[model samples]
Target: LDSVLVTLEEVTVCFSVEEWALLEEWQRELHREVTAATEQLLASLGRWNLWGLLDMGKILGGSGF
Candidate 1:
């Protein structure tokens, strides 16, 4: 998970048009995965760091990627 975040950060630093499109697709996929995981975690655990995960989704979604 840390590695994934690191790679995402690196990718966002600089990218060509093609790379940007790929990155946007990756970002959307990541957002979906995170949302699913977070929902499952909440259902099983009652409560957790949901705000952080949702905040991350918002940040990525808001970036217009």
Candidate 2:
């Protein structure tokens, strides 16, 4: 995983200024979408009392980033 991240960073470093800016913008948008989805999921879980139905440990433990 570390190696992959290093490779990705190297590739990103090769991008032109405009391309880097666009990539940064896209990443920000993706982060916002993920945050919104997480908020909605939490709200639904709270409303439905589904907390015990899901495993929070496994869900939050992975470093997928």
Candidate 3:
């Protein structure tokens, strides 16, 4: 299975407002799982190293396009 961090960064950085703005019925398509998981992880790991958390996400992004 893929690491959550990797895909989370890709979505956050690359996403556009229009692309991410999900309607009520379309909410399931949003990366809710990834976003919540990342936030929780960042909080638990301590917010002192926010940049490090971001970096971990970037690494998971793989060969980014």
Candidate 4:
């Protein structure tokens, strides 16, 4: 019974670790997509010379990669 409990605990820990890793990977991918979209939007806005129409400082809020 003790061995069985130990084995179950080990499996649970392994499963949790794997789940955490998967979530981290998903977060990284999401960040990448958001960054790409932001860059593209910024480029388009720049090309149109419409930067003055929006408050970029408030939008970015100093949060960077």
Candidate 5:
């Protein structure tokens, strides 16, 4: 995993300025979509009491769903 991350970093560093800007723009868009979706799901879970069913301790411990 560490090696893969390093390789990805190196490759990203080689991108032209325009390419990098585009990549960053795409990443921001993806982040926005993901955050919106997560919020919507959490809201639904709350309505159904499913969010309360989850273990708070596990979530705080970084155990992602």
Candidate 6:
């Protein structure tokens, strides 16, 4: 994640107010996609190993985080 952020910092982005609003929408979309992905991953793991997946779900704060 640190490496990804470092790469991001080197990238330049320019946004007007409208563009910023669009960017915010895109961020929310990405967040939802990420949440869905994590949930899928947790569900898949839970099916194979419920106990370990339960611990991982705790560390990930389940759906709250």
Measured by lDDT, the strongest candidate is 1
Using Cα atoms with residue i matched to residue i, what is each candidate's TM-score against the true structure?
0.35, 0.36, 0.36, 0.36, 0.36, 0.36
Off by over 4 Å in 1: 1-23, 47-65
lDDT of 5 by residue, 1-65 (tens): 35322222332223333443556666746644654465466567553233432433244342221
**Model 5 scores what on Cα lDDT?**
0.41
User: Tens digits of per-residue lDDT for model 2 on 36-65?
Assistant: 465466566553233422332234332111
lDDT of 4 at 41: 66
**What's the CA error at residue 13 for candidate 2, in Å?**
22
Clashing residue pairs found in predicted model 5: none
lDDT of 4: 0.40
Which ranges in model 6 have alpha carbons more than 4 Å from their true place?
A: 1-23, 47-65
Candidate lDDT scores, in order, read 0.50, 0.40, 0.48, 0.40, 0.41, 0.45
Name the TM-score of candidate 3.
0.36
Better of 2 and 5 by lDDT: 5
Q: Check candidate 3 and list the clashing pairs.
A: 6-60
lDDT of 4 by residue, 22-47 (tens): 55666646654664565566567553
Residue-by-residue lDDT tens digits, candidate 3, 1-65: 97544444453544344434433534623454555566677668654355654564465452121
